[model samples]
Target: MNILVLKMGGSILAKLPTSFYQTIVALKQQKICEPIIVHGGGPEINETLKELHVESKFVDGLRVTTNEVLDVAEMVMSGSINKKIVANIQKQGGTAIGMSGVDGKTLQAIPIDNASTLGYVGQVKKVNVSWIEQIMEHGAIPVISPIGIDGSGERLNINGDMAAAAVAKALKAKLALISDIPGVMENVSGKEFVHEQLTKEEIEEKIASGVIYGGMIPKVRSALNGLSGGIKESVILNGLAPEDIKDYIQGKQAGTKVVMKKEEKQHV
Candidate 1:
């Protein structure tokens, strides 16, 4: 089966129209591809922390996860945000199962900094794809939260993009990183146009030339990392554009396809 891992950032989740979920359901129902959702809850987690009067800190874009912060993060990501996405899919007539990486040891991880500077932040050391496959066998889409478990049985906060990339690599699936914008855009003679496809070397050259800057640099880098880790391909897609989802599935032009090499074609 053609498997597509969709990574949605929390910032855009709330703003995504109901049509987004419907498109996903339609794709699965049509057997276009097996779609798995891995999501983040950054904005919601920040809101929850603020409401609870907990101090949130960040170092180099990673949240400095203390025990207290980890608790809130898990509560928001695994508890609320995870179910919301599942419910949205169900409402669109799709079978969906919501879970955290801690469930079934799906994402076995180790602390990124040995629990010193980054505290409970972890990087995925291993991915158990069996459980995810089992869920898929039941005709349900798996909606995963980024909270992971360490070998010592400690729950660790994982970067959502990193977690999603790990799952894509494990499944050997194509990854679709849903973003607010259409895709990576560059200015040519004062006109901006999205690059339909990019390679690792091109992406780096664009970054160095300031064509890819600010927030997009990290996103493209994440896509490059997924490509390097054995994912067939990764694309930056617009969550707001539901039609793009179908376009991507049908092997039609839609978003910016990021590949390891210039001549690499999408397996799906």
Candidate 2:
């Protein structure tokens, strides 16, 4: 069975419309093995934090998770978003269970200061796939919230992209990031600018050449990390499009295919 780990970007999650659910329903008709959904709740998290009168900060895209902010993140991610995603899956005729990175110590972590300024955020140190596999084996999807446990047993909020990559690496699945736009654009000047396909090396070169910058840098970087982390392949794909999952699973070119040294088409 082929496992597919999907990371839903936070930018789209707060407003992930019914169309996204429809696409998951479509995947139900495919040959996909276990499809684990790892989701982000950035906008929602910020919104909730604001309502609670908490100020949020970030360094290198990771939220500065002080204890107060950590409380809110855990509530929003574990209690709110995870359930929402699982409910959507069930409504679409697929069974899914909402869980946290801490469930059965599924994802163990360590503090990631990436730079001296960042605080409390975690980088995945380990992932225990048993719980995830147990759920998947029962024909149930696991909706994972990126909240992990640190070295000292403290709970930490990890970045969704990094969390998804770690989970993909643990399962050695085909990882996919579902986003609002088409994949990485190459031509830049036209509508079809997005790469039909590209090797991770080619992608790095584009970033170095300043062709891909800003928001896209992280998106591509996350995809590359997933590929290098142990997944057979990974993608940056259009999340809102109808049946996007089915399209990519069938290699229909709906978004950018982040290659593994070479195209999967040439694989043995």
Candidate 3:
């Protein structure tokens, strides 16, 4: 089966229409592609932390995850947001199972900085592909939360994008990054237009020329990192326009496809 790993950010989850979930169910029912969802809960986590009087800190965009912060993150991501997504999919008449990386040791990880600087922040070192495949074969969508397990049996906070990329690489699946915007946009002359596809070279040029700046730079860099990490394909799709999901699956023009090299564009 062609597996499509859909990575949805917390900010866009509530804004996505019910049709989005419906489309996913339709795709699965039709056997178009097995849709595995990996989601983030940054906004919800922050809110919960504030409510619990926990101070949040960040170092270079990664949350400084003390044991207290890890508790809140896992509670929000694995407990709240994870089930919410499962319920939404079930509401759309689909069977969904929600789990965190710690479940079945799905995402085996190592701390990014030996748990010294970034606290419990870690990157995925390995993935349990068979576990996810078993879930998929059972005809259920697996909704994953980005909380990984370390070698010492401790749960570690993972970056959502990194977790999605690791799963995609392991499953040999296409990674679809669902965003609020259409895709990566570039300004030409004066007007701006979305690039239907971007290569590493082009992305670098855009970044250096200030075309891709601020928040987009990190997002594009993440896509590039995934490519380098063995993810076969990656695309940034607009979650707001859920119809694009089908369009993309049908090989129609949809979001911006990111590739490692220019020659790789033709095959996509």
Candidate 4:
């Protein structure tokens, strides 16, 4: 039951300096039970689409996916990003296993209805997280790729944040999102930080006011969902600073907290 689900976006993955092998090597020394990673390949997907002469469009902040786009998504996400992280962990003397959300029926989903044409994009409908425990039991890290399957056995491109949330809830874990920015900020500029803990509703208010929009919205919403669904707590932290991981894990305060329910908002 001592597990932390860490979700890192492709932005962070692509930004890893020199290589992430050393970081993973360092992390091996810091044993805090099991850590599972779920990752997205956003920038890589966009770049690949451009190379293939595919135009990109968004409907209400969600990507407008077509069958062609879905192929590219799977290639970049499950093929490139997923394998890369697994290799990094392996080179660091850690046992690493890469899997798409489809592997072993680990993740199942339904459509996200943002638009009728957003083909192949899905909202997480279920997560079978026994793989996480099984991997850790064998001394390996489960490095999840954000690709899922539906009831009809069709593939889906699940959002990494939602994917992580669902997996954390399934595993009954503490969710930690690793991002480029420092956690959620009340002010539009991340410079004005909200260092204290916050509630789901308060975070939603920030999203509505435009203080946090764009990508942060999905990340924040995932954190809230994780807590509401029985995961212990969820945090958004600067993955660039891996040293802070210990502090956040013990709830000593390092990132923006979104696990608190709406009723607890007044207390903060």
Candidate 5:
């Protein structure tokens, strides 16, 4: 079965309409692709940290996970946010099981930097794809939290986009970086529009020109990483539209498809 890895951004999780969940169900029922979700919970974690008077910071688009911050991140991501996504899918009549990367050692990790600078932040060293395959075989979507485990059994914070890229590479699945926006946008003559397709060079140029800045930079970079890892294609698309997923499955252009080079065509 072909797999499609959907990377859900935390900023837009709560705002996602029921139509988005319906798309997941439709995909499964039609056997278009077996969908697996890896989600983020950044805004929620930051809110909780603020409530508890804990200082939070970021370095190079990754949250600086101090021990105190790690505790709250685990709670927000693996505990609350994980189950919330599962429940939302269930409410829309889709089967979903939520689990953290630490569960069954699905994601093994090593620190990205010394703990003195960024406490407990790690990159994925290994991914045990069996856990996801089992769920997929059972006709259920595995909604994964990006909290990884290190060698010493310590919980490590992972960037959700990075986690999704790693999982897609492991499964050799296509990737979609789902967010609230329609796609990569450009202000042409003061009117903004989604750029239906983009190559790595175009993405870099846009970033340098200030057209693609902030959160979108990390997303496109993650997409580039997935492409380099041999995933057929990666996309940045909105989850808000009712017909977006259907369009994608039908080979209709629905969002900004990322390619490694301009000469490359869109691949499955």
Candidate 6:
């Protein structure tokens, strides 16, 4: 069974073209691959929180999730955003089930740090792969929200990238981080070129030299984490491109492929 985990970033969700949904449909209906969608809802959560007069703040990109904040996060992530993705896929003739990591303990996590400043943010410690596999076996794509449950059964906000990485590792599936950017690009001969393939050391060197900065840092780090966690391959690709997913499924050079080592290019 070929499984491809797609992490759809919140920033690009709204702007994604209809063709993106069509590609997802093709994946399932055409038997291209079993698609698992892990999505983020940061902007929606912030908007909802602002409407409810809840103070919203983030420390190092992780939202500070108090009880009130967690409530709104659940509503926005699981209720609104998750269904929106499902509806979009269904509209394109694909079967999709929207769910949260809290449902059936799909994602179990522990506090990222004991520091109270970051509040209820959690890092994934376990993923209920059986449940996800069941959904896929039923011919439905699981559109997962990143809310997690803790040891005491408290709901925790899991970073979408981290959540996706954990899911990929647990499923032993390929990971594709959907981003607005095409891929990791650098200036060469005064022109920007996306590195079609990258290894851990090369990614680290570029980061150290400030080539891969800002939001791309955590994304690359998350991809690296997936590779280290037994995922065969990971990539950062443009979600807007119609052929990107198809190309990735065909093992073609469509985006930046993340690898464990430079010589481990057999898969790419």
> Which predicted model would earn the best TM-score?
3
Q: Model 5: runs farther than 4 Å from truth?
A: 189-192, 228-232, 263-268
Q: What lDDT tens digits, residue by residue, belong to model 6 across residues 132-201?
A: 9999999899999999998899889888887988998898788998887889999978999998989999
TM per prediction: 0.94, 0.88, 0.95, 0.84, 0.92, 0.93
- For model 1, name the residue pairs that clash: none
Off by over 4 Å in 4: 17-30, 186-194, 207-222, 225-232, 262-268
Give one clash count per candidate, in the order shown: 0, 1, 0, 0, 0, 0
Instruction: Give the TM-score ranking, best first.
Output: 3, 1, 6, 5, 2, 4
- For all candidates in order, the CA lDDT equals 0.91, 0.81, 0.90, 0.77, 0.87, 0.88
Candidate 1 on 1-268: residue-level lDDT in tens?
7898999988889899999999999888889889999999989999999999999988877898999999999999999999999999999999999999999999999988656988999988999999999989889999999999988899999888889989998998889999888999988999989999998999989899988999898789878877765787899999899899789888899989998887745697
Off by over 4 Å in 3: 264-268
Tens digits of lDDT, candidate 3, 1-268: 7889999888889899898999999999999999999999999999999999999998877789999999999999999999999999999999999999999999999988656988989899999888899999999999999999988999999989889999999988889998878889877899988889899999999899898998788778878877886886789988889988888988898989999865433562
Model 4: lowest-lDDT 10 consecutive positions: 17-26
Q: Write the per-residue lDDT of candidate 4 for residues 1-268, one digit (tens) a residue.
A: 5677888888788666433445444454467547888898888999999999998788766788888898999999889888989887877677888999889888888887763778779978888767767877777888998788889998888878878888887877778878766787665444576545677778877788887888888778867766765776788877777655667765576888775753343554
At residue 256, candidate 5 shows an lDDT of: 88
Clashing pairs in 3: none
Weakest lDDT window of 10 consecutive positions for candidate 6? 259-268
Residue 177 error, candidate 1, Å? 0.2
lDDT (C-alpha) at residue 179 in model 5: 72
